[model samples]
Target: MNHLKLVFIILCSISLVTSCASERSDDDGIEPLNTSESYEELNISYGNDDEQVFDLYLPANRTADTKTIILVHGGGWTSGDKTDMTDFKNFIKDQMPSYAVVNINYRLADENNSPYPMQINDITSVINYLKNNEAHYTISNNLGLVGVSAGAHLSLLWSYGFDTENQVRMVCSIVGPTNFTDPAYLNNTNAVLQELLDTFGIDTATDFLEEVSPYHKATATSPPTILFYGGEDPLIPITQGTTMRDKLESLNVTHQFTLYPNEGHGWTGLNLLDTTLELKIFIETYL
Candidate 1:
């Protein structure tokens, strides 16, 4: 009878081990998350325009102190959708499951419409919407921003210049243009680039360029910032990141800047992993 009882206990232990292994396997790379721990709302409109919509992802444990990160996708302000931010949103959700995410779409620039006020307004509108519904969502008033390229530019501009309520706690820029009036941009002979400048009426006057440029707008009180740049990016000059880093330094603002030496407009492999870790650290530290 004692021997039989010992065998039964061993068998139960083995079953438990197997069940644990199966659960870990089911997780694959994503952390095992309770299905009830989070929820997602897609295509919530903030304004009348089709592009002025955002997707919200709320963690199950969200409360008034739960941090929220807003993601903006890059398409040179002429194209791109909130869908472009999915991988980024998923990465954040996977790494920081406690945080909420708001992925947004803004009006695209065209010959007839400039991106400046329209795109900037769209971002604030989304923020206002979130604030209006924060109680319903059970999220904190604190906000962080992570943006790529043109979207990054807008994020920086808004965080530095337009966040009147001081709600933005941190800002991250990936391959974003910082200085629209940089000589590299003004002197570049690329026709397509020139066309892009024209689309924003940047070539029309330096005043508009200064108005839209994040570097020109950054202040000492600007929120903590993390900037990523590619040394060889054709669309964005290295000065854009470097200059901003220098400006932030002069102002004594809390910031970090990473320039991948061999990278271009985007990264892959270990570079991507490095960026992910850097961003994780930045958000963890500030948000």
Candidate 2:
């Protein structure tokens, strides 16, 4: 792997493994079933690139009222896959058995592909495919989104700005950067962070940062939102969540914000359960 990909992988591994260490136990030994009877499709292509595909699952008991939620994985916008969201997909199936799940892979940022318009466009294509084939899948066009970190950022940005069809009913952002223009990001001196920023094709001279930032794109018409943050997260500042929360409030947009005081970039154990419950409630109410 290249240096950037290696660095990104290590970062993701550490956060995902260690963040939830406190919550797992020897007794939590049962594993979720790998394949469900409700499998609708796998490796369904939405675009030209190999990464522009998704795995889809339907609830066995799905009906007219059943909804779908798209799950996007985080890897600092570069090194993650749809498989990374397997646990969250299982959580949704276990908790909300009536919902359909779409776990997708978008082209990661690299030397050739910048994240902003490329990633944003990929999500739009995925949504369009689902909407077009709703009958074949036996699903409603209304969709919700749950995403982590960079995925969360893309979810919010697309739902807020590019969802021209208004199919997205709600969104849940897990430790995503709501505002890239925040001083917390702009003033960062970390070399790795600087390198990552460069991949986005952003600079101080243009409005590129604001253009990609969900915080700047949110409007009164934005869909209902649920945001989760870790007070101690080293990557996403508490301000990213709080600032967006404040904006959503001022606009009178329906929303919820939760912060786990002791957690970092991610969490484990009961915190995961609580986050799941919150997600269920959000979907029940708005989606």
Candidate 3:
């Protein structure tokens, strides 16, 4: 499978989903913040690294009580940018106008810079920056994460393992890899998949794999989560979603899972619509 094609499909599908949802009216019963004006701050740096910047969208009438949604894009951890999630930012702005949105870019993984602690630390820094500036941004410390593919994995990992303050109220993972140690991954022969996993390290230890896996890090107190997966996805196997769903259920965590059996990597049309609708409901309920 062509990795570029996969990335293209993921981006296009997300755009299509959000675009389709734009035609629908918002009736989620979420009270809109009473701010008189909305604001957009672009390239707000949270750190010295150029990729450490994020774009923040503040809805009109937002206050210290306003909720926030942070979006993380996906390119198998090595590539992708905050701009890739533009449609998602727009979707949240239009649908959940009361909530603030942050679309962020983190240093991508490469031969020297591994994603493990580096990417996770970036997420931690982003959250810390948000919390530190909550008063200035006029938003609450409460956060909801919406991430796709690699971003989804990072979102889950950070929320489950790194968020000690319980700041994340909800998280949504779209076709993210949850378990690196799963048999489906360990026994897989996909070259692209192997290349992506190799970014973690060569001769990686089992303990390290489990340490990085969201499935292994999640606990009973993990925040409410909504998961979406494509059963036919070439990179992520169906078990990645099902096993995580089972684990969440066993932990008695608040969660929902949806599997599109016929889809692969990404989807469009009715499935995409369904995803957006379900996501909207999840955000309304949990965020």
Q: What is the TM-score of each candidate against the true structure?
A: 0.84, 0.85, 0.86
Candidates 1 and 3 compared: the better one by TM-score is 3
Q: Candidate 3 regions off by >4 Å?
A: 1-35, 190-203
- Model 1 Cα lDDT, one tens digit per residue, 192-253: 43433433333336776788789999999999999998898766778999999999999999
Query: What's the lDDT for all of these models?
Result: 0.77, 0.79, 0.80
Please, what are the lDDT tens digits per residue for candidate 3 over residues 3-77? 222332333333212211111112333344336788777888877777888888898877778899999898777
**Which residue ranges in model 2 land beyond 4 Å of their true spot?**
1-37, 191-200
lDDT of 2: 0.79
Candidate 2 TM-score versus the reference: 0.85
Say what the RMSD of model 2 is: 9.3
For candidate 2, lDDT tens digit of each residue in 1-287? 12322223334443342211121222355343232346556778887788888888898756655689999888877778988898988888888888999999999876666666888999988888876666555678899999998889899999999988888999999988888677776665555545454544434442766787899999999999999999999878899999999999998989999999899989989998899899899998998
